[model samples]
Target: MQNPATTAFVSDFAELPATASHGPLRIEYRWVNEAAGNAPIAVFLHEGLGSVAMWRDWPQALCERLGMRGLVYSRPGYGLSTPREHAVKWPVDFMTAQARDILPALFGVLDIDMQARKRMWVIGHSDGGSIALLYAALHPDALAGAVVIAPHIFVEDLSVESIAQTKALYETTDLRSKLSRYHSDVDSAFYGWNDIWLNAAFREWRIVDELAAIKQALLAVQGHDDNYGTMAQIDTIGERVPHAQLVKLDACGHSPHRDAPDALNEAIAAFISRQRR
Candidate 1:
């Protein structure tokens, strides 16, 4: 496979060229125009540490399978996007901040038409999944469907425990250094997410009820062996949103997208295609 650094993508002004603001925070993103004509736009929202480059070829493969247009981007403080300038933890309403403020700014900057598009599909992983649910809940009519992998609807003891382990790895192991090479501002990305999940106010963070407001088709998937969260995370989505369908992949962990790429992509394409039909 050709290196993404050298891939033959239809060259255009690449990632993070657009600029927008959500309150005091600045957001950045990338836009890609696939030749697949008139297919629904498959927007990929990355996990907390993910960026446009971090998604690798998963977005391309999914878009190709569905014959769809696509958008892949980094959220604020992740990837090539702007970094958090302070040491503060994430806001309790961080998901809401992404949904209500950052998302609309991205669409506006990229000129994505939520009203006229035949379908708007979001495939979000981890923190991005929560943000996607927030968007779907607020604008149920704006999206056709969404696929959430390893999403956290309610904070759990296990989640905190796992994050604590990762924090230690950051301090002792070379995980932070390895990640630093990938992210331009690794501290901004890591602490922005890790610190928030570890904060006191965030312990009570739960949006299970808010998701019921989303009437659009939804798919929630998780792994049995996920170290970061439990099966209850995905299961709770179905309990709250009657329309939600759950899929569990055994032996998989926090990042189903990376751990089980083929299965993850297949499920996403099929779910979006099924909605179109």
Candidate 2:
């Protein structure tokens, strides 16, 4: 199988004007298995501090396993994409805006027509997972399915604690320097996510009600050892979207794709196969 990570260095760019007055955002993205014409597309949304480089070869591996093409991108303020302004603070509804506005515009810019949209599948992790859920909710008919790993449907004390700790690490530890390798503006990626997540108002952030709007095949996966969120996250998803499937992996941390790649891939592959049937 061709390694997608090798091609990540040569990313494509698109300029999407901010919905607010924040100016145009230069989005950095890459396509995997584009040669696999007519195959379904799997859009991979990265974690809060993740860039396309951070995904390594997981997207390529998964695409090869499923015989699908893949799209992976660094959202604004991440990777080589336009960095977030230092003075600006992300609103509590930031993820929602990404789902409702940014993603659709990206699809348009990339010429992901109606036919392609119908065959689109989203596989998102962490913050990306939340965005995927919101996107699926906003356009229930647009996506074929979605697999969210360690998604946040509502705020939790554990989540806040872990985020606060991460912020401390970013400030004091070499985490910033390490992360800088992946992002052009490392602070833009780190603080943009950390600040909003630790905000007092962010504690009230919840998407449980909004999730009820999603009608597509949905799978929520989380790790047993995930420190960022608890099982309640996926449990709430199952409650709101009764048809949504849930998977829990033992001995795994916040990132199931990294901690349990084989298991995660098998679970997602099975879910997609069932959806096709």
Task: Tell me the TM-score of each prediction against the true structure.
Answer: 0.89, 0.95
TM-score computed on alpha carbons, candidate 2 = 0.95
The whole-model lDDT of each prediction reads: 0.77, 0.90
Model 1 residue runs over 4 Å out of place are 1-28, 116-118
Model 1, span 1-277: residue lDDT tens? 1123422232232232444534344444445556876667878889877777777777887788878778887777776556777665678998887888777766765667866332788889998999888988887777888889999898999999988888899989998877775466788888888899999899999998898798889999998888878999988898888878888997788988789888877777777667777
Q: What CA root-mean-square deviation does each model show from the true structure?
A: 3.7, 3.2
- Global CA lDDT computed for model 2: 0.90
How far in Å is the alpha carbon of 62 misplaced in model 1?
Answer: 1.1
Q: What is the RMSD of candidate 1?
A: 3.7
Candidate 2: clashing residue pairs, number:
0
For candidate 2, which ten residues in a row score worst on lDDT? 1-10
Q: What is the TM-score of candidate 1? A: 0.89
- Model 2 segments more than 4 A misplaced: 1-8, 18-22
